[model samples]
Target: MADSLATWMPPLASLDDALLRYLDQTGVAVLVKDLTSGRFTAASPCAPRVLVASQDIVGQTDAELFDAVQAVALRAADQQAVALGTAYAGEHRIERHGERREYVVWRHPVPASGEQGPRILSCWQDVTEQRKRDVLVQATLAQLEEQQKANAELRREMQDNQVRDSVSGLYHRAHFEEQLRREADLSSREQREFAIVSVSIDGMDQIRETYGADSCERVVEALGRLLKANTRAMDSPCRLGGDRFTVLLSGVGLATAHSRMEHLRKACSQHIVAFNGQQIPFTVSMGVASFPHTAGSVEELMRSADRAMAASRAKGGNHLTLASIQFVPAT
Candidate 1:
């Protein structure tokens, strides 16, 4: 609640023309209260916007101008500012036309003059819209973070599903070759040994002719499962199309690779696939070779392993073979 500008202006200070225009035009509500009489002594032209319109606010107490609850709060803040002899700030919520609004109020105690006694200067600023915008920004940032995480998970799943052979669930030949090159480089650089094994289903042609293509697929799938089960997580097992498969064993030597492959060969020979109301038994032949033992390079190692596998199939099905060590003269 406020009075005419001329009546309240004289006590506070000498107001210049520019200061008078600013007080009239600004949205901030400025008011002064007399501490002794507990009544409003001065007000800006815009002060009426802070409360219900009244004809005159001069010499009016908060109880006469505002509701009971607001009156008590206003009185408390004024007393606190005067007692502290400094500026104090607080927030208040008011409802008008069924719409709730928020404001930040600041109060400062003005020293008593010759006859005016002490006064409290107060300014009120509306902050409802700024608070709403802050909430909206926080919610938007949270939603965006969730969406980014979801997209990253989706991309990982897609990569896992797309880079493997559908039937064997093992990496494709292209991926296998990439791994081969990487392993070769690592072994050469670190002076460490690793093994490569080439595998093929023995008597595959005869089995396909005797039991149809579905039977062949059943046998291949069974061999794939056995290979996966027998290999370590660090090993790379790949399906190189048709009945061919290969494994790369990291940090393994020739003897260890041969022992592991022999175990896998036995597992393949023992596994039976059930199909079309009949059980089909199958066998796989594998050849084990090591880097710097059987061959010096990736290409040479693969060729040597393939030759050994062919030799095993020549002997009989369900057998494992090891590539011969290359003899080199002392340099």
Candidate 2:
């Protein structure tokens, strides 16, 4: 059987002149489709213009005008709209003259008069440029968010580098002091106790004299690595210059703090510094002081820990000492 719509349509002389003229002059594209035959019965002059085609579109099905995939989509929508006797509205993409275009289209189904069969009234508006602009805007927004995230990460890295020691990769003296003051304030306000452990290498001066400056520096670096390895994530480890190190253990007592430092001391005693083919032995004395148990203020706590560490070093090198609390008048 013939598939051409002209074979189903009446003679060209029977067309309504007023309607044809009106459609020719109208800028909007409109079409009437025979739902039973699945072919266009009539198309306005503007319909051909919208498709960038100079030939008449009356006999052309979507399969002739578009690729197979696009035709299948359009046919499905048209069939459903006609079956339901309702309006269809959607976006459709098609390739024309080797370029892709988007359209906002609507199809309205209506019963045909007498022998004309079922009909579909369809119209489309070009929306290709608008969709392209929307895509570009979304891409730009995503790039901006990524850039902001990178900037935030860079700022955090720079701040960390500023407060880290070059030799030990531990907190610098100023950063350690800042943390000390913050912990002291927290402890006072909450009436909770926290511990601070001070560490010093025993006979460091004698080791420097015997091993030379290079060996002494290496020993300091080694101790810094050991301390960092032994401390917990919540603990703040700091190198306070020379052979001195400190750890601020938040929410811990003198006993637990002393236990942790004793393990570190044991590690240090077993650690060997091999230089110039000679094994050099080293050990650290640690002093533990708690906020309410040892002193009230940061300055007093530091002094007590320092005095205890000095006492331990004087007595024997590899020992841990607990500081006795000193009374001070409330300010």
Per candidate, the number of residue pairs that clash is 0, 0
Candidate 2 runs further than 4 Å off: 1-29, 42-46, 52-55, 201-234, 263-284, 311-319, 325-331
What lDDT is reached at residue 245 by model 1?
91
Q: Would you list the C-alpha lDDT of every candidate in the order shown?
A: 0.83, 0.81
TM-score of each: 0.60, 0.72
Relative to the unseen true structure, what is the Cα RMSD of model 1?
6.1
Model 2 lDDT per residue over 1-331, tens place: 1223233344333445565556446545667778887778777656777767656677777787788999999998888887777888878888888889888778888676667777787876677878999999999999999999999999988998898776777888898899888888888889888999899888888888898877887777788888888888777899898888888988888888888888899999999998887777899998889998898778888888998898898888798889996667799
**Tens digit per residue, CA lDDT, model 1, 1-331:** 2244445655555545466557556667777888889888777767676553454665799888667887898888888888888999988876645667788899988887777788888887777888899899999999999999999999987896787887887888888889889888899899999999999988888888888988888887788788889999888999999989999999999999988898888788788889888888888888888998999989999999999889888888678889999999999
Model 2 error, position 9 (Å): 15
TM-score of decoy 2: 0.72
Indicate the worst ten consecutive residues by lDDT in candidate 2. Answer: 1-10
